[model samples]
Target: MGKGHTSANGGSRTEGYQYDINEKSILGDEWCSMYSTTAPIKFEKSHFETAMMHLIREPNINSTAILRADILREAVFEIEPNGKPKVKEEKTQDLEVTDPEAKKIGIDDLDVRVAPTNPLLNLHVVIQIVRRIIPRNLYKDAIMNQTCLIMNSSSSKPSTSLVVYTPHIKAEDECPFYIPHVKAVGILFHNNVLSVHYIPFDNVELLRDESQRAVRTAWRLLQTAYKHSMGIMEGYEKRVNHDQVVDKVDFQDCYIAFKKRYSKFLVDNWAESTDPKKHVFEDIAIAAFLFELWKKIYGKDFKEKIQFKDLGCGNGALCYILISEGIRGKGIDARRRKSWSIYPPDVQAALKEQVIVPSLLLRPHPEVRKRIPHLEHNGGLFPVKVAHELIAPATIVYSSEDLLQSPQVNVTEFSPDTFIIGNHSDELTCWIPLLGYPFIVIPCCSHNFSGERVRFNVRKSTLQSSSKSLGNSTYAGLVDHVEYIANRVGWKVEKEMLRIPSTRNAAIIGYENPFLDQFPTQEVYDVIIEDGGPDNWIQNTMALMKRNPRSH
Candidate 1:
């Protein structure tokens, strides 16, 4: 929506029509001015039609933070036998376009086929209007309702297409470089060319200077949408479907309230080496997600239904936030972090130090723990036996003592009600889904089944699903790899692309469906064992259990 107007001098030539669009007479210059731009490239008629529809239905595609759009009414006009045009089908409801007192200034005349009261009445024209609602970014209390009108021409000869503008322009309505600013901005596809016409009240400068350039850029994008055979909101519907996997409204409300209470305090006194803003907001967002998820799963009384175990929880911020909100949970990591002391006593108590040796890994590996070889009471350990040559090498063999005495949680022993949170849990990320407990794992830097940092290669079949270009090195690939593993097991998985400050925001959730009897089955353990036996990992994990002098 440009501020200033160009002098209406040259009439535009309609592609197949014999007559030229007389600029001076078509748009009367009594109380306002106009600015127009034209391009010679031609576009498919459908391209023009689809773009117009997107401009109405999903205006947020071209702008930022626009809340919603609703079509108020649609009026289709047909040329009468006597050359005049009358409405054929219309749903005026409360918004009658023909109201004389409304002062809705629009196209004054059509120098081509329309000869009646106005060009909007041209034969086969559909006058569609939408009420766009946008909330102010910094000032949420303020909102604006701007009505956009789109008139598309008949599919027959002349080939002149849609024209976009506001229903009215008031001099006193001061606004930012927002679309249809103050007055009306028109985007027209006519005569195989693209054009932009801005109308401003004669007394007001409207959105000038910076707004001038912004409006030009806005129209240019509209032109780009037309030039290519795509809608500006091409995948808008698809995106909404993908994004709504979680309850967005509830998540947003929870996240904002949590951030307001905790962000400033944490950022001011962060004790970690990572960026405070990144870590703090991420934890806040994850905590918010969990709160909403727990509510849906266990109802409002979710606090008593289950407790969470966060394996490899970094910084313990997420545990702190959840515990502060009255949810009982614990954060376990390989080494204690300095940030633990910054939290209150409960969060401090919840943060425990130890490496996670999944109970599954400790099952078959007797060699993993030789029961303190130097201890006098301990009998000489016998040589391990092999069940089947293939299964023996792949699986771990450990006695009941290893399960009881070792400083690691046994996955099989956890109560069925435990909910696991794997916030960048590294080596444990893949194991969370397999642990048979309902869990959420957010993948960060690439890591294999072992904590040895190695990028997971995306499978060929998965790569071609939606993102054919998904490379092995990308975070998307890593997230997809986790999803693949979850699907390989029998657990029904739900994924949500979280709204956090960092790029590591994909949350993969696995659970047993309550309505349907669907729980995870370990049908894919052969391939899992082939990846790497637990011997190397067991030694590496045990090394971390040695205490580091606590950092102040």
Candidate 2:
């Protein structure tokens, strides 16, 4: 009499007949077929005809099979305590559930709690899978799709855990699809279900060529958004533009000098003069602005005992300005030449005359001349007479080469309150902060452990995800890395948009606050290791400094 019943002779009869049905096959179709030849049929009448006989009989084979099939069906889509289907909704249309409680039920929505947070574990798994899958083109679409799906699931809005995996749609054979930037992936939560919106890959063949590009695009977008939000881009732009101008001027001057020395070579080369004076003038203006910045931050006293070390003291123009201000400064560089001849003879003569005033005057006094012969030859008792007095212990000790790499010098020898200024320290940007001195670094190029060039680490992901290399000599990407590193090391970092000479902008200014307790020496090493492992610049410097503290 049940649903799985039939009569003899194929008659449409139903009373106490039983038949077994395949639950798997039945569920495959939307509608179940009854009395079909595919289903086994059985019947029993005597067992039920006489109630006095007690209808005692053996278990019906057909009935037992039918019961087993029904049990399997129940297991597949068993109702939960809330009276909602427990199975995942595979079809998108099937997701349209009216019950608010049932709406959150979906395939990807199952909550699997993980404890003891480890972010790198997931990334490592993904990376390993990617590396193992040869011919990356084959799985490119899947990987991109997965990225989009995961990114979209992370909702900005508060919601219960619910996931939905959209079925892949058939793609046209000739159509092309490109992945969108990772930063553009938008996540939304509606009715407790997370929705991910991302670009679907059409051609998997381009994966190998496009992988790096896609990652870079994503990172750049993220970085741009962060910089804009933080209002650092405007400042960065000004500094970069100023720096470019300064560089152009120096390049032009060098070119002119070469041409002047070799007229035949210049004619043969047919190189025309490019006037970079305008750029030089602009740089001067930028320098003035920097001076104003220093004044504003430290007041007029900034010119006092405070020593500024131009890490890469090119041309010594800045040093000249500081010297004019009576600041004790020294300029060091790998390349040294006597260009003082460029000054007029009268000026030079005046300097020379003043330098020998003491010697000239003390010549008559044997006692004075013996003590100061150099000065006594020129004049009485005094040496180097000029409009302004020069201060002692150079205000700036900079070099084009790696100053920190030198075995005889340690950073601490500069001064306890020295300001490390990397106007454009190039590769030195990475090691600038490790000196444990107050620093102002303007990043130019990107450099990392593997030595691969990158713009920025746009993703707020793990540090390794952001690791990149130092490209051209002018790129200061390492400075940006140092910014992140300094913060982790507990140095109060500040960024100011300097109105400077180049477009390669953004200056990370850091200071050691006396109020805060000094970070443990070991902690410094820990930070370096944590930030993209160890590198030669960091390891060697630390080792050398440890061995010879006075040499740093």
Instruction: Compare the candidates by lDDT and give the number of the best one.
Output: 1
lDDT of 2 by residue, 1-552 (tens): 223222343223223221222211121122111112222212111111121011011111111211000000111133457644454322221112122222111223222221111222121000000000001122222211111111111223322121111222223332213333222232222232222222324432222231344423333332322223233313322212223212322333323233233333223432123223423333343345445455555677787746666654443444444444455545433222132233234322211100000011112233444577763222312111123257553223223133333443333335665676665544456555655667777776665432234354432342332222222223333544667776766667765444444555567777754422443234555655665643333233322222311100
Question: Candidate 1's residue-wise lDDT over 171-221, tens digit each?
Answer: 434443445543555555656655555555553344233235434454454
Instruction: Give the clash total for candidate 2.
Output: 58
Quote the positional error of residue 325 for candidate 2 in Å. 2.5
Off by over 4 Å in 2: 1-279, 282-286, 337-412, 448-456, 459-479, 512-520, 532-535, 538-552
Model 2: weakest 10-residue lDDT segment is: 124-133
